[model samples]
Target chain A: MIRWLLLLMLAAGPALAVGDPADQLPNPAQEERARVIGRELRCMVCQNQSIEDSDADLARDLRRIVREQVAQGKPDEAVLTFVHERYGDFVLLKPPFKMATALLWGMPAIALLGGALLIRGMRRRQRVAPGPQELTQAERDRLAQLSGRPRE
Target chain B: MSEAAPNPEAAAWRRRALLLAPLAAAGLGGAGFYAMLRGLGTGDYDPRGVPSALIGKAPPDFSLPPLEGTGLPGLSAADLRTGKPMLVNFFASWCVPCVIEHPQLMRLAREGVAIMGIAYKDKPVDSLGFLKQRGTPYARLGVDQPGRVAIDWGLYGVPETYLLDKGGIIRWRMAGPVTEEILAQQVTPLLRRYA
Candidate 1:
């Protein structure tokens, strides 16, 4: 019975530790908005983690700022722009399409098209008749000389 | 010869194109790979520095209390527009780099540069104690407890210094500890330019 109780407690432990207590807001609606925004903002310090997932001090501060802005009735884009203006494009998990990032976004499609064209060309080349196994002028001349015939 | 002999010039051109096409693609691919490697190697190039969006913009207003027992007046954004260039430094007792940067601040203070210090995220008592031992270089010191002021200033971390022109527009920002070299080379020249 004690072993079963211990197993049950272990199973429940993960559920208790799932959500971050620091991210809670006074209003549930505002908290949900903050959560959505936080997921979109990258933690500048941690680089790899979103502000929602990072436990870095700067991330916590940013989360508070987001919650405060949301509580103040700022829209989602306004809140994102606030952080974006300060940190540049790097703070956004999804970088906006702009002149600077045009090449970055276009490279994959260009590579794909280029690959397709290359494959098509290769297939076309294979379908072409292995054009006349004709001898070169030197080879013909040598052949004629070796066969004891007059040069043509 | 076969039923139809291929045009020799055209065949030669086709052969050259076939040979050059993959070579050109490989060259491009290699260049792209090299660029990617260089980008990755220089990732987090300015890890300590985040360029402030507030540059050329007026600083946000604030009325922070002074650090206790420092005998220095509290600072406001309006005070920065004194018709002369000034430096605003964000620091804290808890920050190790702030301690390292203290001497450079002292030298600037001694040279008659007007510097305003914001004690970020530190207790008044601790900040006062730290200044007392290390010597306060600020003409005016403000205590930013919750760091709302620092946030408005677009601060990423402690030990960031901003050079503001006479009109209170931020001209330049230096993140991380101010070494003697940076103080001499970048800071002094900009200060003179604005002056």
Candidate 2:
């Protein structure tokens, strides 16, 4: 039981370290909002991590910026636009649907439709396929003769 | 009895189409891979390269103080719009890549290219020492001790260089150290085109 408790604490450790206590907003609601926005914003320095989750200096700076904006009562979209203006679409984890990203956003749907069509086509082919036919009387008699048995 | 067959003409066309589908996909993938390899060789399509949003826009407003103990003037946003193409290099004293990139900057300076330097996240004393050792290639040097200006410029890391057109619009940004090959291949062509 002690070992399991130790393992659980180890797993919980990283989650506890996410946002620095000093970086949090005074109001819990505002802090929560800041975290929501931070999670959506990519840490440009870390490439694969959200600013809220990364320990990089730039990420920490971005987190502070987000909390500051939130504390200032700026709307979520306004705060996002502030960052988006500087970092471009790459900083948005969810790339906004645009002409440049149309193919990227459309690929999954296209693949799904293509796959459905392929399965449908295969099913249709299986249904139309020829089945075995019964042997004629003449063929049956020939088979019996070939086997060296008296014709029945 | 066998189920009715699909329309003969349609079936034949569909069969051939199905047969060609994998080949077509393979051909497209091969072409993409070939382009990617070629891009890799030319340093053109780095998966890590983040295209700057600052391109075609003015640099963010900033007025950084000159590095202490250095006699160079401080850099400001207004200074960049002096009706000539210039380079804005963000480097740090501790960044090894900056040392590698220094010779290229020196050569450009010798050829009369206007280059501005921002000492990002480094002590002014260290920056002064680094420049003194490197033979100072910048026309103006600024110290961004807290790196606030760097964040505004969307700097990813140290040793990033931005090429500004004559209008002060940023045309290109490189996130790594400049090399002789990069100078001859990318920088020279862009300088001529923008000039």
Candidate 3:
């Protein structure tokens, strides 16, 4: 009798184990946390969108990989590191500041400084009185015509 | 008539403002260009660093339609809790990478690795046509029109494959075309471990 019961339990094990979508879902808290993390990651396949936004197969695979890693008790940083190792910096929306990627980080500041200097230089140039040589005879004539005065 | 040239102070202020105008314009122009460069994704384009929400969590539950005449519906991560492990591949008819990885998928399928394909964000007819032309190695295929299903899976693009163990836990995943080296080194070993 016990053996028959054990056999019955074994037969029911898989049926019990098979879960519907609601049953198999991760905890809500965990899902929210994962969603936050996913939002920061770039989708390797889709150029502009975050992984959270993309529906590309590559994106889905990436999400599954992230979920598995998290479930395995890997830290968020470690999970990112694993992906980065495989896909290179291009897979990241935010590239770290490294020798290979330093330009990306530096460009904005460089541009701002350059812009300020150009503005300052233009201001200085604008302040400089028109050089005596600025007006050619043709310009003088045009000015005179416009002013209704004789050309000098 | 106005006395000589303007007062020295007025002339200096006028000169300063005039000089500053172009300089300010240049500065604005530079800033605009900088923004443009950043937005363009430039050579710095990288996606790996993008954080993932699914990381460190269980895969979402989802299903796909079966390939033609397989009778079985598409396999899901939930279904993977069965006896053997499985692989899920996201592909599209228009994707070059899908073509590149087609043979790899076929080999896995032939080895009884339980590989399934999701026809991601593609037209059904085109996906079917692609399978006809390239030979379907997928045990089944699910259509993901408009890519919402892929989004639910957190997909970035097509040609991504996920490995699930007998317990329905994801074991491995690949982002791009699965090179032979990758298959030999990473996927095959994982399968053996799970097997």
- Interface alpha-carbon RMSD, every candidate: 5.3, 3.0, 10.2
Better of 1 and 3 by DockQ: 1
What is the DockQ for all candidates, taken in turn? 0.24, 0.43, 0.08
Off by over 4 Å in 1: A1-22, A26-29, A107-132, A136-141, A147-152, B1-48
Best by TM-score: 2
Looking at model 1 chain B, report the run of 10 residues with the lowest lDDT sum: B39-48
Summarize candidate 2's per-residue lDDT along B58-171 as a digit string, tens digits: 999999998867789999999998888889999999999999999999999999999999999998888988998988899999889988888889887889999999999999
Error of 3 at B181 (Å): 1.0
- Which 10 consecutive residues of model 3 chain B have the lowest summed lDDT? B43-52
Q: What does DockQ come to for candidate 2? A: 0.43
Instruction: Give every candidate's TM-score on chain A.
Output: 0.70, 0.76, 0.64
lDDT of 3 by residue, B134-195 (tens): 77777666766756566555566667887777666666666677766668877898888876
CA displacement after TM-score superposition, residue B183 of candidate 2 (Å): 1.3
CAPRI-style class, candidate 3: incorrect
lDDT of residue A86 for candidate 2: 86
The pairs that clash in candidate 2 are: none
Q: Each model's TM-score, in the order given? A: 0.74, 0.83, 0.45
Quality of candidate 2's docking, in CAPRI categories? acceptable
True-contact fraction in model 1 equals 0.30
Model 3 CA lDDT for position B55:
37
lDDT of 1 by residue, A1-152 (tens): 99999999999865653346866897898998999999999886667888888776778888899998999899999999988877677788998899988988899999999999999997886678576569999999999999999999
lDDT of 2 at A118: 100
